[model samples]
Target: MRFQRSAVLCLLALLAIPAAAISQTMDYDRLDARLTRLAADEDMVGLSVAVIEDGRIAFAKGYGVTEIGGEPVTDDTVFRWASLSKGVAATEIAILASQARLNITDTVGSFKTSLRLPGGGEQRATLEDVLSHRLGILPNAYDTRLEDGWDPAKIRESLKSLKPVCAIGECHTYQNVAYDSIAEVVEDVTESKYADAVQRSVFVPLGMATASIGRSGLQNSPSWARPYSKRGRTAGRPKEKIVNDNYYRIPAAGGVNGSIRDLALYARAHMGLVPDVLGETALDLLQTPRIYTRREQARMSSRYRGTVRDARYGLGWRIYKYGEAGNRVVGHRGAVEGYRSFILFDPDRDTGVVILWNSSSRQPNGIGFEVMDMAYGLPFHDWMELDTSQAAAGH
Candidate 1:
């Protein structure tokens, strides 16, 4: 009888071990000190960071000022999402797919009949093609045109003028205009504007109150971080100056804005905490690797190359494989003229990080990875130190 009791107690203790580890508090004090020092060193105007662990927000805080000697950034301070909008847009589209409103495999030209490849006959690009960056469209072929006030319709009409750099589904080429065509596809399917669809489907469901899409969204925001760019060279110790550019024309590509707090909810949804809001199937589909994005290895800083074994593009997220076992990390990074943002999550560990900055710099990515490492209790790397070294070496 004593042996049985001892065995039961031992089993209970063993069962509590995993739960205890999962519930452990992260070293927020260390993170805070590091972020404060890095912001000062990098001349960052304002930054917001949030970490999700065990399917909930574990830590979230803002650093620095919204502008030079301006308002302090808070959890609710909105910032331009830039290309991070891609992940949000993809999530909404996946929701539509879950409801059978549209099939991701459906040819994009089926809805936007005007959009055609170079030959202009049968549409070779499907909805997945555009979402996964496998449309074979040359990178940013018409991004300048979109930025110059050209409407998405005009860009769609102009598709015939541009040729695919590679065969459809054969190569990965990042795009803005081509991906924005998903907006038109969504509009055709829902008979509503893209922003409205996103607001109704994604923001409302996720309770992301401060999240909005496009120029009007930012303008109407009650509180938002002012856009700023580093004044001189990338490595120069310079001040940040306020700057602005309108990207509403390509809303689907890079036009969403939200606060770090709101983004934490989105991250939680992706981590499978809110399955009823975003179906598990849809979430899986959005994150499942679709095409090899060879650019990640070459584009990422050399410091991260040691851990990142492979990379791929999913529906709207960039999937990174770290270590030999290839630990899965799904995330997206965004860069507009004056803003930089990143959101990274590990589904296996149910850990995620969101970093939004009003200033454009490579520091956010390194900081995000460090936070993730901390969440998983992995060996720490001094990313900021490496960043400083790279900058001094003119890398």
Candidate 2:
């Protein structure tokens, strides 16, 4: 009958709705169950997560207690982004480049940084090289000095004294001090403090309400999660930790602080959702693969080791091929003492996961892929390693 034919057409149309639109309505019972189990786990002190689909937040929630028995974690509970802050710097640079305010190809020596590479490598090295970890210096150069309370500026000044591991632009040698030196260039060009420029350009325009830079930003939050660890005499029980300002001193490489909501918004903008905040050109510039990261690929979880391949470093991001389809996925993970954060998203699909936890557990690392599996219509896998007691093992 005509009525039956019309009903069939209507049903087909409804089923044909773009996945992004229906993603908002997708049942999250599986995710909720996993998060609930994680929150109650022995090693997980406090955690918050946000899932994004098509540039919209599909789900945002917090789990566990802020400080062992302290306040419950909420989406608004601020947590340190740790090295995840590097992405902010990369994003800002991309925006600046789009506006013709600065050139990433400029030599590092031309800036105000004290990054004197051996054999005049700084002269040969470009700002893009610095952001992409192509400094050819020792990995995490001067990180130990920074943690030991040495003056950050002095630490940067000492980078020139280190030996080169490879020629500049030949290999990916990560650096926190040398990396943070980009802040000086940003300050010079923006005619404002690095943090102020980031605030005005990225955070404010993207509406990252609780996002901020520095130690004060984390401590000053109305509700912030305290870092925790199972070290010392804790008998494997996570204990509250003091918030160290050492890494915060290198605000560009680290020191970003924000809530789950703020991070989700940040990810959404990076997905090219907020055109007013960021455009495709800026996103492309920030995410283009610049250097292969073989060590990074080796560090992947056993579950992902097979599917995630050809790892590479971008401006401040990590790019890898995922799934049987070899889909390009952009992601980054960060850790600082007792806190761990992971962000993974498919820019093409505009879907990703952001996780923040205030403990030394890497259990949540798998959750990002679990969400992505659902997005990709792949079968479920125990990427979270929930069955194993080794979930508390270091990332």
TM-scores, all candidates, are 0.88, 0.92
Give lDDT tens digits, candidate 1, residues 1-395: 11122324322321212323445656776787888876775556789988877565667788888776688888888989999998877987899999999988888767854466677522767888889988667887688787677766677678777766888888888888777777877788889998999999889877788999876677677778877766563456335544444466678888799999888888877876666677678988899989887777767636675666478999999888765456888898899877889898887676788999887667767887787777667788876554467654533
Q: Write one digit per residue (lDDT tens) for candidate 2, span 260-377.
A: 8889888877777666678777888888999898788787735475768889999999999888898989989889988999999988877788999998887788889889888788
- What is each predicted model's overall lDDT from 0 to 1? 0.76, 0.83
Which residue pairs does candidate 1 place in steric collision? none
Q: Number of clashing pairs, model 1?
A: 0
lDDT of residue 88 for candidate 2: 93
Error of 1 at 131 (Å): 0.2
Candidate 2: clashing pairs of residues: none
